[model samples]
Target: MMTIRRRKTRKRRSPQKKRSRRRRSTKRGSQVKRRRRQAMTHRKKRRVKRRKKEIQTRRKRTLKEKVKLLVINLKMILLLKLKKELRVPQKTRQLQKNQPQKSQQLKNLPLLSQLPKNLPLKQTRFQQQKLRPTKSKPLFLLAKPRPQHRLQPQ
Candidate 1:
């Protein structure tokens, strides 16, 4: 009987096999890297959006506060102006209330019994004359000589 020997099978590979395998692996690595970069960029964008929202809310709050303050200030100013306008009437009414009725009645007594009304009438006439517009001379006219100055030596 002859001795039988087992033969080892050789592994077979094409020339382009290594290059194709390397290209496929490189493509997968690049895809993974791109996904990671995109995820980072997305997170950054979300953070920026959140910050912008916060800033917008803050601005809105500040604007509302300013408007509220403006309204309050306007109300206060109106109240002060109204109070000022009211003061004169209030003082006049108070003065009217404080006057003595007897004194007022005395003024309406007979002309002989009452004090002379000439001074008050004169004052009122003066006031009326002051209120009236006086006839103004034209600015270009020369003045006439007075009689007293004419009598005097030149």
Candidate 2:
């Protein structure tokens, strides 16, 4: 069964109510701005923290690699020193046997000095000296033997 009832009629709001609503809406705009500012600050802080962590990790990796290279260089220097120390006695013993022959050659030096010199060609006088051996050694092999002939790694 359907019962028919008379509907309640709408009443018009007062001017004060409309004014209060406008006031609340204006206040809400400022509140929205404050919330957005807080969110922006939080995001910036998080990004800065992330960047710091990445930089620290990079520094650690670089430090580890540097330590490894330093260790390798030290090992190479130690090995070179050990090899030179062991080989020195053997070389001195060999030089003992060659002394007589070297003295004979030294005696013949006077006769060789009497030979006529070749005339210089189109090149400069000092230019041919570049092909001669040098006494300098590399910085890394400072503890190596004197007059290093050839320290080829076996």
Candidate 3:
């Protein structure tokens, strides 16, 4: 007769797994280790969140800088085109000399610059009195609010 041997499966007592960094003194120590691992994971998550925010702000600033550079390039090109159009300043200045100057027109009529003292000047006391209203009563609008008619059910 052949003897059939039964195999009993048992948990391994040796600490070799990734989560085996614990002393076998008490359960509280194990809980402390778990809490530490949780805190480390949370800290890493917060750091990742901060890094994402920094990346977003950097992207926005880069976009704004790109727009500013494009605007500057456009302004430079337009300035170059304008410089080419106004290549000769001397001829334009000579043409402008032909037009009558505003100061030259005013120079012919000297009477307009200085006024004669014969014009009537208001007295300062009367002018000051007219500026302020002496009436204590409040002035109101002439228009009065019309009475509203009652809505009738036809």
TM-score of each: 0.39, 0.47, 0.40
Query: Residue 143 in candidate 2 has what lDDT?
Result: 23
lDDT of 3 by residue, 119-148 (tens): 323436864454443344211111122333
- Deviation from truth (RMSD, Å), model 2: 16.4
How many clashing pairs per prediction, in order? 0, 0, 0
lDDT, model 3: 0.67
Per-residue lDDT of 1-154 in model 2, one digit per residue for the tens? 9989989998888998867764554578788999999999999999999999999999999999999999999999999999988878977978877778745754654343443333223334564453233445322222222333333455
Better by TM-score, candidate 2 or 1: 2
Give the CA lDDT, 0 to 100, for residue 136 in model 1: 50
Error of 2 at 141 (Å): 31
Q: State each model's CA lDDT, in order.
A: 0.68, 0.68, 0.67
Judging by lDDT, tell me the better candidate of 1 and 3. Answer: 1
Q: Which one wins on TM-score?
A: 2
Best first by lDDT, ranked: 1, 2, 3
- Which 10 consecutive residues of model 3 have the lowest summed lDDT? 137-146
Residue 27 lDDT in candidate 1 = 78
